[model samples]
Target: MLTVQPLQPATFPVPGQFYMLQAGASYDPLLKRPFSYLSAENGSITFLYRIRGKGTRAIAALREKETISLIGPLGNAYPVPSGEFIAVAGGIGIASLFSLFGAATGRATLFWGGRTAGELLMTETVRGLVRTAVITTDDGSAGRKSLVTEPFREYLAVNAHLPVYVCGSTPMMKAVAALCSDAGARCFVSLEAYMACGVGACLGCVVKIRDSENHEGRFRSVCKDGPVFDASTVVWEGQ
Candidate 1:
C-alpha cells in the first residue's frame, strides 16, 4: 500500500493514458517505468505492478516514510458493468478489476489466482468493493489449489449469464477466453504490454487486427486504443 507524503499531485491520466513514475534518483536507466491506474480516491491512485528488476526493487524496498513519484490516473477504464459481474484474475491482474468493482452495483463474483496465498493482494483489497474468492497454487493456502481460470470456468459453467472480465498473463487470458466463448459467455479482457512511452505518441504497443470500425487497416495501439478490449473483438493473432 502507498502512503500520502510530501504530496506532489498532478492530474494527467487521460482516461486511458499512463504516467512515468520516477521512483527515486537511482534510476540507472535514467527513467521510470510506466504504470496504469487501478483506482483513485480523493487525489490518490492505486497501481498494480510486480517486482521484476533493479528499478522495481528500488521502489518496492522503500519504507512508509519514503515516497515515490506518481504520474497518472491514465488509461481508458473498461465499460461499466451492465449486469451481474464476474471477474477472473491471475497474478496482479486483480488491479484491472478495481475500477469495474467500483462502478458495479450488483453482486460481483471475483476469482483471483496467484502463485501463493501471500500474493493475493488485490483479493483483500476488494473486500469492501465486491465479493471475492482467492485461489492459490499452493494447496496449503486458502481457496482451491488450481489456476485462477479453473474456478472462473467452473463459475462460467453454472453462471453462464453473468458478464465476465479477465486480466492476467496472455496465455491465461487466451485459455479462459476460448473456454468462455465456447460456453457462449460474454467476456472482456484488459491486456498488458511492454511500454516505453505511456501515451499514444509511441507506436511501440501495436496489435494487429481486422479493423471492424472502418476497415481502413488492421493495426491499433494497445497503450492508446486500449489495454482493455472485448474478448471477441481482440484479434489474438499468433495465439
Candidate 2:
C-alpha cells in the first residue's frame, strides 16, 4: 500500500475509478499497472496492492523522491443511489469501496471478507464511516467464520429496501447479484478485468452486457463504458 501526493490534478477522484501506475523510471517493465484508489483525502491518494508479480516487485523497490507515472481517474465510478447502502467486498476489492465509505455518513454498511484475517485490510478506517460493519474470513480468523454473503443475506432479509454495491471476484459478485435479484433489491457490481489500454481503444477489457433491444446482448469495454455497472445489465457466463 502506497500513498502519494500528486503534483497536479488533485481532485475529482471518486470511488471505483482507477489509475494506471508505472513505478519504474525506465522502460524495462514497459507497461503501467491499474489500481483503484483506496482512499483520497486532502491532497494525497492511497493505493492498495498485493505484491504478486514483477511489476509490483519493481514498485516495491521505489525510494522516497523516486518518480512514478500515472494516468488517471480513469473508468466510471460507482453510482450514488438514494437510499441506504450495503457494500460487499472480497479480498482487496475493498479498494473500490473505501472512498464511498468516506463519502457516506450513516447510510452505508460494509461487509468485508478475505481468505484469512490478515488479508482484511483497513477495517478501522472503514468502520468509522459506515453505520455498521461486518467482517468475515474463510478460516474464522476474524469477525465470522463464513462467506460475506451469509451476513449479507441476513442483512438483506431485514433491509431489502437498501441498494447493494459489490466489488470482488467474479463469482462472488455474481452470487451477490443473484441474491439481490431474488430479494427484489437493486445491486451494482464493479468488475476487475485485465486492462491494457485503460481506455476503450485496445478492445482488451470487454464484458458481456445485456442489450434490451437485442436479446443476444453485446460487449462493452470495462475501461471506456464502465468498471462499475448495474448488476442486472451484466450477462453472466452461462446466460
Candidate 3:
C-alpha cells in the first residue's frame, strides 16, 4: 500500500482510472508504470501494489515526501451501477474496484479471492463499504476454501439479472466473463496490460476487441479505449 500526496491538489481519479508513476527524477526504468487508484481523497491518492519487478521495487524504495512523477487520472472509468450489482476482485485487483464498491453503497456485493490470506489486503475496508462481502482463499487461511469465482457463480445462479464489475488476473476475468455470459448477466472488466506510454500515442497497450456484429475482432488501445470494457466485446485468449 502506497499513498502519495501531490505537491498541489489534483483532481481525484474515478474508479478504474489509473496513473502512470515514475519513482524518481531519473528515469532508470524509462517507462512509467500504470497503477489503478485504490482511493483518492483529501489531496492524496493511494495505490495497492505488490512488488513484482524492477518498477515496483523502485517504487517501494522511495522515502517519504520524495518527489515522483505522476501522470493521470487516465483511461475510462467503470460506470456506476444504478441498481444492485456484483463486484468480483482477484488478489490485488481489488485496488481498481474499491471505489466502485463505495459508489454502489449498500447495493454492492463483493466477491474477493486470493491464493492466500495475505494476498487479500484491506479486508476490513471492503467490509465497511459493501453490502455483503464473500471472501475466499485457496489455502483456506481466511474465508471459504475455494476459488473466489465459485461463490460468485453460485450467486449468479440465483440472481443473474444483476450486473457484474470485475478486475483481476486475465485468466480470472476471462472465466468470470464466461460465467456471466452463461448466466446472462452483464459483465464489465477492467484490464491490465504492459504499457510503454500511458496515453494513446505509443500504441503499446492494445487488446483485441470483438465486434458486436461480425464477431471479428479489432485491436483497441487499452490506455485510450479502456482499461475498463464490456466483457462481451473483449476477445478472450481462446476465442
lDDT per residue (tens digit) for residues 1-239 in model 2:
88877987656588789998888767767778889998888788889988888788887888876778888889898887555789999989988888887665547888888989999887887787778889999999999999999999999988888888999999899999999999998899999888888988999889988877866668999988889999988988887
Which is superior by TM-score, 2 or 3? 3
Across 207-231, the per-residue lDDT of candidate 3 in tens digits comes to: 9998766577899999889999999
Question: Model 1 — which ten-residue stretch has the worst lDDT?
Answer: 11-20
Any runs in candidate 1 off by more than 4 Å, and if so which? 4-18, 63-67, 132-134, 138-140, 213-217
Task: Give all TM-scores, in the order shown.
Answer: 0.83, 0.94, 0.96
What is the C-alpha local distance difference test score of candidate 2?
A: 0.86
Name model 3 segments beyond 4 Å from true.
Answer: none
Candidate 3 clashes between residue pairs 3 or more apart in a chain or in different chains: none
Could you tell which candidate, 1 or 3, scores higher by lDDT?
A: 3
Over 1-239, each residue of candidate 1 has an lDDT whose tens digit, in order, gives: 44333377566333233455767666575655766556666766667677888767777777876778654554566776766788887777776676677676775787777777777775555776777564656454767877777777777898888888888888888887898789988888877777666576777777754456754346777777777777776767564
* All-Cα superposition RMSD per candidate: 3.1, 1.5, 1.3
> How many backbone clashes does every candidate have?
5, 0, 0
Off by over 4 Å in 2: none
Candidate 1 to truth, TM: 0.83
lDDT score, candidate 3, position 47:
91
Candidate 1 collision pairs: 15-75, 15-76, 16-75, 16-76, 17-75
